[model samples]
Target: MIQKSFCAIFLFVLGLGPISLTAQSLEIDADLRARFEYRHGFNNLFPDNADPAAFVNQRSRLNFNYTTEKLQLFIAVQDVSIWGDTRQILAVDGNDSFSLFEAWGQIQMNENWYMKLGRQVLTYDDERIFGGLDWAMQGRFHDAALLKYRKDGFMMDLGGAYSQETDRNDGNDFRIQGFFTYKALQYAYLKKSWEKSSASFLFLNTGFQDFDVNDVADGVSYRHTTGTYFKFPIKIINVTGSLYYQFGKANATTDLAAYQMSLEATYKKNKVLYGLGLELLSGTDQDGAAKNNSFFPLYGTNHKFNGFMDYFYVGNHANTVGLNDFYAKMVFTTGEKSTVLVKGHYFTANAALTGDADAYLGTEMDLVYTQALMKNVNLNVGYSHMFASESMSLIKGGRPHDNTNNWGWIQLIINPNIFKADLGTPSN
Candidate 1:
């Protein structure tokens, strides 16, 4: 019953353990991750005999935090699996991946305002378009309501959301099926900082739930996005930029315009770190164009963009043809907690490609290595390769040039903190 009333209001607020009204505090944390993979062509393309998909996935978390002086709270609980897919004597958990990733609260109404609400995490700024995907182990949330504003360096937020699937008595059909479900959402964010430069802006709106073809519920289809992000510095190079635009209606009969743009530059010396970038998304062609120019970066963290063996958009490119990444990277530091990263990409095809095919799609290489193994642990390793073409095997299928497209991985992370308290302040 609602997860037993959220575990009895989380053990009655963790047994009301640390409180003093104006100086309260409490914390507990944990997060464990595990990963291992060995797919042959990771997110697509590698067919000839097939049989290369090893596994081992995990992610477990527990977090609770609380504060006072106008309240603030958080809660998280997670579990994600895949090792042997359960079954070591289970009663019921054959794979629903336990969850409740976040539960929020924030109240502090004067002095710059605040009023967050439940199930949060809507990262902004360079996240392209809201993100907190946290490398996917079931890490994305938003059951919104916000109204925050900060001071000095400037900040602002105003959000909203509404979705339905239960507690019904009327109608507002949001029969949650997914692949990006949304029946309402609104957003606005703003940022400004200086001392080195910064800027941000966003305005989003989503709402989709229009069916009919005997599926009933027909009404709701709004899509709109607007964006901006930029950072500055130049004497030693460190620049960033982004621009976005998407118009309304991507459902209930298409009609959506799209766009995305990007720019990047980096420079660091002493331990190396150099980069370059380019990006553009806006597509629709392969001849089915009715009205829907593809440019979906919807909820960011698309595997941190373009390459990582995730072949486009992470959930399979929507509305096709879009993209034109061009990149370069470097990181090297290899010691005192190690580091290394090497990257490259050069894909193309931002429209038109289905007649004699070939808009040059292919080329990727990525390598990663990181180590820290202490103070909360960490380790990661990676590999990737993909050099297809023939138009990426004519839009991602197989063969065409498949020299065993590649991918490999390993990861481990642990975050610990397990408890803290301090109810200081309040004497006579």
Candidate 2:
């Protein structure tokens, strides 16, 4: 297998020297990322029973694209692994070490209509409720079909997906990691943009497989989520906000009524950018057998919110008392190629707490500095510190160990175009 991974600048080196005037194009895109991380306390304060961990993780990918007047095709292959695993990775089976990351095709139905089907990534707006989650080594993709329409300043997309009833690799269809995905899904997304502002609306439905109580009834849990994300600029300040509501049964037996809200403002002047924001996700009432009020941003890029340490609402924070996050952030540019970012966050519970826990959760501080190494290469370093509270300790299900204190990391990113061939009349 060949993998072309690098920055867009590398594409120039892979371009074909000669072309026809047929207006057809073929291109290759590659991304190579390697990161080494060391942590005494990465995700949470380790509970004394665990030790510090370190690892070097990397991701490599190569994608091919073919485009014509009304037809398009794409295929992406990828491999992700830790350093020193092995010189030769066996990929005949379904594993993260090697796989087809994406394979999709698109057809233009009319002047403003298009349809796409296959394994692909879906992202919209600020990525609060839906996203690709590219920061992870394996990233994220869905096997689905999407119908799209675009005209002027407005766009619309409708998508649907279905998975097999089990995890076994059957005669046809991929496993989809079984329990990790829904059995069925449907969604609609719409967006409109003006000169200085933009807004989006989305509605999603998902159903997951479950075990029946008596092994004789239906075993599908269904949920519905709807939301809006909007942004506008007023004078020197930019304002952005998002709100979402979740309803319907979380399972055949559990009823849910949950929601989320967030708001932010930013100012950019001279060489510095400053911002302040708040986010709230409703939690289940401790006294409730009536309904579940804990919100879950199912497909969102959870790693980007709450805090960089990802202590809450990433994966395991579901159905529990949710969170309230208030934060302030600033970015300073030094010279033309480097920038520094600093942020502070105060967290609490959106609802009541467990045990004698007060509403006060904790505070955290994060810092990062990034520099461009070259056209398509960059370097980043970051550090974060978390101060745990009684409520946090209670929620974490452990005594507040001295561990939730600090964490640090460094990463390198390089992307390059590996090859390009053109046909038809060249724009140049």
Candidate 3:
């Protein structure tokens, strides 16, 4: 019923056509991605008593978009299925459900003002520090409304949203956020000379309960995050840096404060690209007694982080164990239709330890080949290897230990420009 109401409202608005008949536009686009993987030693990362077959899973995503002069909308639906004898582990019941990833509308009031409301993504500057966190099998979203103003190189935004625990519940948890951005400077480096430097600030306040009903009874929790990023070109290298600080209260008991920083340098020339990155995070333990000096990736895409195996910062676990990651990657194109990419990751634990203990250490390597099968169809094959350290394997109790694991994946991406209607078509 809610979905139907939303669609009806959307179509009604879309039916309004363009605000200005002289200057109107329409566009439709979509992206479809699928992944197949094979695993070895994958069970090493899970509990020892757990079945190895449970680690293998295949996934796919279908993303669609439609836009006009005054409004824009997008949706991404995902599906995951198990292959071979791993069927039971990947249950196909309620667990397999379609989701509304991004369903939003944009109202462009004028050249310098607009508003977007609904389930949408909010990404700013370099996603390295503040992003939509879109790397997971299912990305993240907030039921929110956003107002934006833009002119020249300056932009400002205000947003708010609510999430209810019950269908007919009266008390609905909510969140509010505000952001501002400005391009401080823009210049040329050498040769063609192209450069852009900008700064952004974001403030978010949220009050919500945990997934389990028993977690927070009455009190509301909140988290405050502030971040900034700077980017420019020096010689042939592009440099970027990011920093973030978060403080809040969760469960009405524990007080939380954390921060993270990252630095990156990239060099691109011709069809070759190479880059290096470093990231650090600081947080606290569940007891709020010991300080956990880990890495908080925020909304950045984790797959684009330290390693492809995605052991740390996968969620909040890295918040427990301190993490120090050094990453590097290179991409090169072949002919006009094929491309090759290579990435390497090195990770080590930075947690404050009492005794002489080996921190977790790991390395990952990825190789990818891409071929443009057609104008809107592309095929990619990828393989990744993860080598774990002693700290990742050893176990203290009878439970299975965290060990090194190896996994590989193959994917296909289809992006088609399905339709393009004149901006004034509706107005006419």
Identify the leading candidate in terms of lDDT: 1
Question: In candidate 1, what are the lDDT values of residues 168-212, reduced to their tens digit?
Answer: 678877778687679888888888999998888888999889989
RMSD of 2: 4.7
Any runs in candidate 2 off by more than 4 Å, and if so which?
Answer: 1-22, 87-96, 165-180, 214-217, 286-289, 424-428
The TM-score between candidate 3 and the true structure equals: 0.76
Which residue pairs in candidate 1 have backbone atoms (N, alpha carbon, C) closer than 3 angstroms, thus clashing?
none
Q: lDDT values of the candidates?
A: 0.84, 0.81, 0.59
Can you give the lDDT of residue 307 in candidate 1?
94
Among residues 3 or more apart in sequence or in different chains, the pairs in candidate 3 whose N, CA or C atoms overlap within 3 Å are: 24-423, 25-423, 48-400, 281-294, 281-295, 392-402
Off by over 4 Å in 3: 1-26, 41-68, 73-96, 129-137, 167-169, 172-195, 210-216, 269-271, 283-295, 316-318, 394-404, 422-428
Q: On a 0 to 100 scale, what is the lDDT of residue 172 in model 3?
A: 44
lDDT of 2: 0.81
lDDT of 2 by residue, 1-428 (tens): 33333333235323533333346777887788898877755566667767777888888887778777777778777889888775556543234387778889899889999999999999898777788888787888988999999999999999999887555653323334342378789999999999989999999999876555565435567799998999999899999999999998877788989999999999999999999999999997444447889888888788888888888866667788888999999999986999999999999888787553588778989998999999989898999888877677756767564565677888898888877776565454
Candidate 3, position 226, lDDT = 66
Question: Each candidate's TM vs. the true structure?
Answer: 0.35, 0.89, 0.76
